[model samples]
Target: MMTVVHHRTVDVGGQAVFYREAGDATAPAVVLLHGAPASSFMFRGLIPLLADRYHVVAPDLLGFGYSAMPPVERFDYTFGALTDAVEGFLDTIGIRRCALYVQDYGAPVGWRLALRDATRITAVVSQNGNAYTEGFVDSFWKPLWDYAEDMTEEKAAPLRGALSLEGIRWQYTHGVPDTSLVSPDTWMHDHMLVSRPGSMDVQLKLFSEYPTNVALYPQVQEYFRTTQVPLLAVWGRNDEIFGPDGARAFRRDLPDAEVHLLDGGHFLLESELPAVTALMRDFLGRALPV
Candidate 1:
């Protein structure tokens, strides 16, 4: 468990960004970036494992988590802007080189930083991160994509309902093998994130901005091929959202990339932390260790 050590704020582009850090500062850094509707709390369980040997840091994205959201007008909330924010974060903390564990929305954030600072990345451990053309499962994302394409107040807003606590519980267990593990508090917390004032609007707009990333997928693949950074993909075999096809696709761009499709769904990290953490530790030890 992560013992609260007073939430510290960092200045990123004039925004007071909040984050949680653990372990020895002198150790090689291992930063974890979370996805939509989630805060750094997503990695709370895994932090202690990595913290024992590596400096671990996890941040709530600008508009998500406990971090400050300076109105949509002040910030674009697009991937380009987020990538720049993360770059500034690295520079502010003076992390010359670090290994990144990316999940969900973190896929784009980490990839954006990877493309810009490929030389600075020593290793990457991705849990359900996007890569290759196959990873883009059209059918699974069709509903959300359609909503983003044609958002309106009257249209069937499954995506909108899906962001709520009740909806999130279903999402976390739609095709999951272990429904028993879907704790009430988990859904409640995740729901609380998207339910905050302006949070729903933030998510809706971010959904609209997702197409920009879809358009830039090709560039992301090229970066993986060109950078040749040590990469590993740990995906939940039963992920209804991202699907298994996406996991196989990582090999097309990264032939040497290692992949592990474990038993779980979208939020696989929550179910398979021990396995994921072990894989990350082994990979980081060889590729980016102190």
Candidate 2:
């Protein structure tokens, strides 16, 4: 494992955004946006492979990893807020354009960026990120929507508690064919992020807002179709949460997108990094005109 060589912070809309960067500074920029629960650590294995060829930037989203976590009263963890935070982060970094590798919760932030600043996106590589109703399994998420519908301080505590270490481990390894692959450090890191003061609240609030994305997926797909940018869907065939169907459906909106399905779970890149990294390199070569 390569040690973290650089760390920095930039204020984005009054919130301090923390990010770690590795690899060549002069190479083409590639931003790795991680999903919920996991931080930039999701790309631990893949970063080294691309760092030699690309300047890789990975940040712990608002409430994840080393980033700031204001209370729910102070920071709304809605999809809009998440998008705006990333937009501000990009502006602060002076990244006019970048190849975006988005995963899970990253879909909302990346989609928002693609729509809000279409010209700034060079290429899009998505892993298990969806932009259509068929991509979602409502049954898996119905309880969350129901909780949000009747949210209250008294009832929300249980939801917050559910993000604990044990809860996180369960969610992370849930439905995986081989649970032994999930490392202790992975669960430890994710649990640490959620268990932070008020961070759990932010996560739960974000969970509640998931329904909004379900309703807004059509808009995201339309934005992609309109932008006509290069898109790739690298899916984990074994993902229990978000199925392969989501990856297939992405092609409906992005007819030109390149799709690859691999044998892994929601966290495929962790288990299968080399193959994914090669796919990313190939995708970038095809998507970005030199």
Which model scores highest in lDDT? 2
TM-score each candidate: 0.93, 0.91
CA lDDT scores, all candidates in order: 0.79, 0.80
lDDT of 1 at 211: 77
On residues 13-82, what C-alpha lDDT tens digit does candidate 1 reach at each position? 8976778888787889888888777778788778878887888888778888877776776678887887
Candidate 1, superposed: residue stretches over 4 Å from native: 1-6
Expressed as tens digits, the lDDT of each residue in 123-232 for candidate 2 is 88989887776666665555676688887776566666557788667666765566777777887888876777777768878888887777877778787788777888
Candidate 2 segments whose C-alpha is farther than 4 A from its true place: 1-4, 152-162
Clashes of 1: 1
